[model samples]
Target: MNKIVYTLLIFLIFNHNFYATNYYVSNNGNDNNVGTIDSPFKTIQKAADIMSSGDICYIREGIYREEVIVSTNNLTFKNYQDEKVIISGADLITNWLPSDIGSNIFEASFTGAETQFSMLFVNNKRQKMARWPNNETDEMMMPEDVKTGYEDCQVFNTRSGKNGRRVKFPNLSGFPVDHFKGGIFRGIVGKKWINPMGIIESSNDTELTVTAISDDWGTNSSKMFTDNGKGFGFIFHLNALDQPGEWFEENGKIYFMPPVGKDPNDMVISAKNRKLAFVLNNRTNIKVDGINIHAASIAMKNTNNCEITNGSVQYLWPFFTRKGYAVSKTEQGGIFIDGNENLFKNMYIAHSWGHGIFIDGGRKNKIENCFIDNIGWIAQFTSSIQNFGDGTIVTKSTLGSSGRFHIRTNNKIDITYNDLYDCMKMGQDAGSIQSTNGGNWGVPLDLKGAEIAYNRIHDCNTLTDGNKEFVLALYLEGCFNYTVHHNLIYNFKTDVVPDGTFVYLGPRMATIKDCYYYNNTVWNVDWGLRVWNRENRGDVENILFWNNIIDGKANDGETSDNDRNVNSLLAKLSFKTNIRNITGNGNALFVDANQGDFRLQTNSVAIDGGTEVSGITDGFNGNAPDVGAIEYGSSFPDVGSNIDPEDISFELISDSSTLSTNSSDLKKESIVVYPNPSNSLIKITNLSNNYIEKISWKLTNLNGRELFTGKALTIDISSLPVGVYFLTVNKTKTFKVIKN
Candidate 1:
């Protein structure tokens, strides 16, 4: 009885643990226990710490100021009730206090030397003042001495009819009121000194104001100043605008203004410590989902099998620096997967300081259904950044940079069904989706058994002027057994001055087969397909170009230039011969000047055409073969009745010997079968072939997998499926059958 009870208890516990344990996180909670409905953990990192496999951590709506890192495997972090869970930086509060009286010291300099000057104050105790020179010359002059000098300066008064009065200085240039009293002069603004006078309501001095009448003083009253001296005092000194000052309140809101000579600090945070927001070192089978990760110097580094899905990562721009200044210090990428076999899906990563999704060293990794844009903005490659402008999507580093994809070493990597646009200025290293260099150690060396398919690559050469070595689509080098099929490449050349051509297959052992190059329209392009072999490796053999449609002409006029269409295809071959069935309406192939050892037979249809003999296939319409992409063939019929209709039905008829035996008994003497291809099973009611042994039948596909087998001739084949199949009889010849 006790054993039975213990077994029941164990089963209950196992069933209970199989279901996901739901944990809730809210900002209002203070406890760390994720067990209760009311009390929950305050931080995502705290919740992630205790989460086990098959656990769901539901976070509530609120701004979280902490960084959450999930190294747990198969754990899901989702929003509980609200999706707008803002994970932001820690807010630092800054308090400000007003400056006390006589605490600030102001001075003036003219041409790197201290000067003493005066101004006219018409509203002072003495309207007319005399100018004075300082008895002592000091680097830091007193405000009272500067004010006394300004009070003694000459002034010209002009009465405005009967309402107001105006005053002006006699001399306009020399000693132009270089010192001021009880006032702060701001930074210079367009050849004029900007000063801040004391609160006008508190001062007992007559409220005499001065105004200028020219268009020079039009709408720039905040920065411009006039020398009309009257009750209005002209105070001049070094401006306090550039200096760092405290935040002040005017109505009820606070405003921060810097003092003179003080520039705004644009460096918000320096990530020189190589601090990463999230680091995955030698980890596996970890999943990070639905988190906003931003503002780290390096967002993520050295992760493997780490799936990051349904999230966004963006780097914040520097606050007050000029454009392109602090680009190097910004965050590196949304996710940097260096290890092998990682999967990233449905992630929106953009506006990073570096590559959006950088998979440096990985094998068999898959990145699909993700939106990656606006990357490669690092300051190290300024020209490349400028070529990308503001619309860079993604980049593989390849400017003699140490960070390379290293695809040559690792195989079985698939990059498909993702929108990659607007990333120009430089091509990738070897084995990338597209590369620039075509030498032996060049681009194609990395592509061993790689598959490039089903992508829309257009408008690639938008920035063509700077780097003339740009290969728009792909540069094939040293690659072997790779496939480039079913991709839409159009409108690649956007610049007038052509930099580099498109699709160059270098001196490499590779195969280009079964690729549908239909509607691959190009304008102003130098060459459609350029293949060369300067490396003399002798391994550049068996490169096939089957079933491809080459439509446009080469921009170069020469029939056999490297930039010419057919010449580009022939430059890579060693012993060229007549291609089989290369059909097209336009000029398809061009042989190079050095291609003399190559020969085309009299029956060879590609005598004048440029296609190689190995590229052509036997499945063409012409007597021999046509030149380029278009194949001339007989018009296909409606594809009706490959077999006669009499072959559709099957029946079993009794022989004359069976009927002659007995009409009622119908002694099974002989049986005859007709109509080989039938929709249903055949009937074997009258078995008259007495000498025949047991009947055995088998149905198979072309590769010979017996789908259905039976001993009885009247087999119930209602379950036998439809397709072209073969039926074999053990007693007689095998018959080809079709089930419809």
Candidate 2:
């Protein structure tokens, strides 16, 4: 009975451990077991190894020197303390050999400013040490410890102030050496300065190759070198340096250096490709919230059905050299969504080397309330490579197949209420959000059934100097069934150039209606809106431009004919050009000489002045519809309500006959309320138009709870909230009620 009781207790404990497992990883303990809270693992990799789907690996605060790769499908790797969890490289060289005759052999430098001391040496060969005579006198006396006495000495170069000199040597093994080069013989002229220069470059695995080197005999040596001998060099040994470091390797993965520091912008000394800081690859129903991802390259890609909300992504720009030319271009981003059906909301993505949030070849996505600034590219999607030329090259086309295609047709895309500012360049083969001449490169082929409304797009032009005309406010082409309305676009100007233009609309049919363009101002631009239909197939029809206020005063002073081209297109189409109600100083319209046939109708109110169509009933305003977006007033009823206070009655009049009741003799009076269903504040002006003493008012909700009770000819209703209410007024001799 005792043994059975013990067995049952052990079984229950094991079951409890299996069901409630919360792994923890810190900078202590062996990284081999299931990382529990008490018996925790040392590294994040160990925690990941034992984590299954729906498992959480909570990491403690410390700088970890390992590239954590997540192979599990649905596991999370997060930090507990919200501190910096740095996974960096090892910093020590393991296998090293010391040589006495250090002529061709490069040794580590002791100078603190030298950044080349941490390099690793490969293809080390054994060679015999040679020694010279110690002195001219005392020839019979032999030097003790020959390897340390005279064999290790070499011609050392010392710099005093701005000058440097080379003098021959000391003989010591494993001693500190300054600026030593690698080769065959020490103190020899040809091989003295044969140290190999360390090379660091980035390339794919397909470009890796091995080559053989030649010795002094002109024969092919057995020693092989990598591409350009990049990884083959001698660096300062660890013990000779000021900072003590260690080389850590676990599970066949070697880490070569520690993290530079806790700061994400600190430079890292490594050669291996780092694992992504954040990855969203082929995932479905995944959501990441409120993460601050900074200083990462090639961060995220190939994700699907993921939502990233309330996050910040910033890249650190580092100086680099390419073909001996100094260049600085950081490659980092926030969330890179490549799959389909993702949502990003309320995110602040800035200071990225690439786009803030790059969406490539995805369908049915929604990006709302995002603040994107100081990024390379704002938002882009394309279908044609030719249209995306002269921008960032995201993907290149190959033989027998076109390049990357968006192919996302009718995908229910919504870009609303976003603040896009100061996003400069697009990625490789990808144009800026306004580039691509309206996303005509990738698949989906068209922006069919998309909505770009209620956004604030300003000051995004003039990022590139060469193509000032490339700047655009809102560009659309090859898209159908799209709507751009209710947006605030202003202060979009091009850089100073002769050919700079703004707002390019290509050969596509679209509806641009109800967009309140207040101060849609431009500077140094050739035209405000350049609508060019090259196809000439009349496919660009039913393109409406309604209620747009364009202010292009800067370009009005130009003597060139470019301004005439835009007005000519408007005239040729007999398109609606409503210029009325404008309160600015500039040329209203400029038509070309050859396009005289296109004319505004006489007395057509749209010529120099437009009829007031704001409150008109008919959709089309006059006998001839106004040329522009806004039409002249017509006999049709306007859009707003026509409140007739006299028509509203609360009287119990006769149903069988339109019998009369005297205005003043009636015991009960009919009350009328104007502007019923009011927004925040309601006005209850009496239609009786007569002064009566002591008019009492009461307002009640459906539950009959009195919301307001007051007595006045006109009451202050600024404090009332939004809802339905009943208003009752009592006169001295009559009682009347109304609904609001």
TM-scores of all predicted structures: 0.45, 0.43
Q: Give the whole-model CA lDDT for all candidates, comma-separated.
A: 0.36, 0.34
State the lDDT of candidate 1 residue by residue for 81-118, as single tens digits.
32334344322112323333223312211121010111
Residue-wise lDDT of candidate 2 within 124-234, one digit each (tens)?
A: 101111112222221111112242212222222233221122322332234333222221121111221121111211112112111111121012111111111111111
RMSD of each: 31.9, 28.7
Best by TM-score: 1
Error of 2 at 430 (Å): 11
**Clash number by candidate, in order:** 27, 49
lDDT of 2 at 401: 10
TM-score of 2: 0.43
lDDT of 1: 0.36
